[model samples]
Target: MEYIHGRTGDQILGSTSIPAERKGVYQYMATAIQKLLRIPIPPELPPPPPPSALNNDVFRLVMFLDTEAPRIYQNADQLELHLNTIFITAHDICFTELLYLHMGSIYEQLKGLSNEPMVFCYGDIHPGNFIINDDGHITIIDFSETSILPSSFARYAIVSTSKLSRG
Candidate 1:
């Protein structure tokens, strides 16, 4: 990849000429995330969300999770518990707020959003990889580990790194 000319999202988001938060920067980050996931998946994803039928989006997500995530789910109750706890925690911390909530009941703060489907991810997302060019466009660098995987893994990467960043 050519050396992109611009400060990364991390640099611009920290102490610098530009303030950390901006509508344009967030917009670019969201768009860049979508584009990053569109990268080719090394392995084929599990079945695409079941197309028509009484199946809504949630059912398909559950189907995917039951297969890929921690192989600990036994019954529906067990699965629900695991999904509610781990997946919910990861998403709340990594995706929604862009900052992990370290207080009690953080998981409950985000209740009904555990159905994020699998997509090709950068496999490694951190402050540095998200780039913001001089032209106000964003890009996700590091295609080395990009592939189709559970969104939880990507979210986990963010949570892990953000903790380090916080420290």
Candidate 2:
């Protein structure tokens, strides 16, 4: 892995409590991920990787990062704390509920598009997975969770509730 000399979106958001600034960072992240999802999947490639493969890798990495991770969140409270620390640092309280609802909606939408075209997706697009370099450009770091999914699903994954402005 190449060394990245930069701060994570997590660290930058954590160091500030301003909602606008945080949202700006999230917008930047959304833009970067959208660009990534636009790359067309090669037609000659083999069958898409199974979702289980990505899940297993993520599980193993999380376990390696925190040995007690499995036992650490035994209930909703602990789970909430853990999520707050790692994932929802900048969003408001309602954002989590909205995120879940949006995810459910996207899942239902994608179900109807199983026969639609596919795209290359990052699979995981959280703040921690992105880095802000000294030049202010955002770089996506991890690709272990990358996969080919329905184009609509990939677009929803990045923009979530926001409408993407087309020029």
Candidate 3:
């Protein structure tokens, strides 16, 4: 395992204490997602461990890790707040009609994702999972939930549930 030294995106946003920096956080996150999308999928991956190796002891260990892991937000309120902030920032940086159009396509794709082309995605992209490296670059962490799904799923998942309207 390699060591990464720096703050999480959440920490950077919290410490900056500036509303405008929140927009930068969204841009940083976008860059990270773009980078993640560019990574070539490994042609072959190791299979899961045998059931014998996943005995009670190992199960307990895995459960502990899952429950204790740091997450982006603990509940809906936090998620809503963050999404609201991101949307506001995004709106300021780009044309509202374009953003709406992009979001509309995402929603439409999500509605029919099962029939769409798929791609490997991080599966989970929250502020806490993104590391702001010491050199000021965004790096995505945590691949436990990675999977291949509709290419539009990521975009839809990012902003679909938000209160932002199609119009």
Candidate 4:
């Protein structure tokens, strides 16, 4: 990983939040993502990585319990749980509808854009994942989740798919 010399978007948006300044930062992020979204489709693209584990209820329930209440795991608590979403079902009789929506919406939206022209994606496009250069340009970072997907599917991969901003 190369050292990127610049202030992160989060740093730029410190404590005093201003309307115009935040808007500019968001615009920069959109512009940078847009640039990646316009890359020419590759000739023979590799299959995308496995969908997020959040797509599976058993997996997600285990994850949720692990996050929301680790005591359940520490004590070896055996609890049956399910997750259901308007977009997808993580299990037969799902219960965690709200959480499922984040992962499922991405899956359904991506499935719908399968045939569209592909584009390059940094895959993680949140403010914390980008740097604001001295020249007012935004630099996207964290290529660990980088991917190439249909242009229409790029947005689903960039933002709103992760557990960020949701508590």
Best by TM-score: 4
Model 1 misplaced regions, further than 4 Å:
13-31, 38-116
Residue-wise C-alpha lDDT for candidate 4, range 6-26, written one tens digit per residue: 888778777348989877777
Residue lDDT tens for model 1, 94-149: 33332233222433433322354445544455557778877776667866545343
Off by over 4 Å in 4: 45-114, 158-167
Worst 10 residues of 2 by lDDT: 54-63
Q: Global CA lDDT of candidate 3, please? A: 0.48
Model 3: per-residue Cα lDDT over 64-109, one tens digit each: 1352212344322343343345546554322232234444632221
Q: Locate the minimum summed-lDDT window of 10 residues in model 3.
A: 52-61
Decoy 3 TM-score against native:
0.50
TM-scores for all predictions: 0.44, 0.53, 0.50, 0.55
Candidate 2 error regions (>4 Å): 46-114, 155-167
Question: Candidate 1 lDDT (Cα, whole model)?
Answer: 0.48
For candidate 3, list the clashing residue pairs, or say none. none
Off by over 4 Å in 3: 40-115, 160-167
Task: Assess each prediction's global lDDT (C-alpha) against the native.
Answer: 0.48, 0.52, 0.48, 0.48
Give candidates' CA RMSD values in order: 9.7, 11.4, 12.9, 9.8
Model 1: clashing residue pairs? none
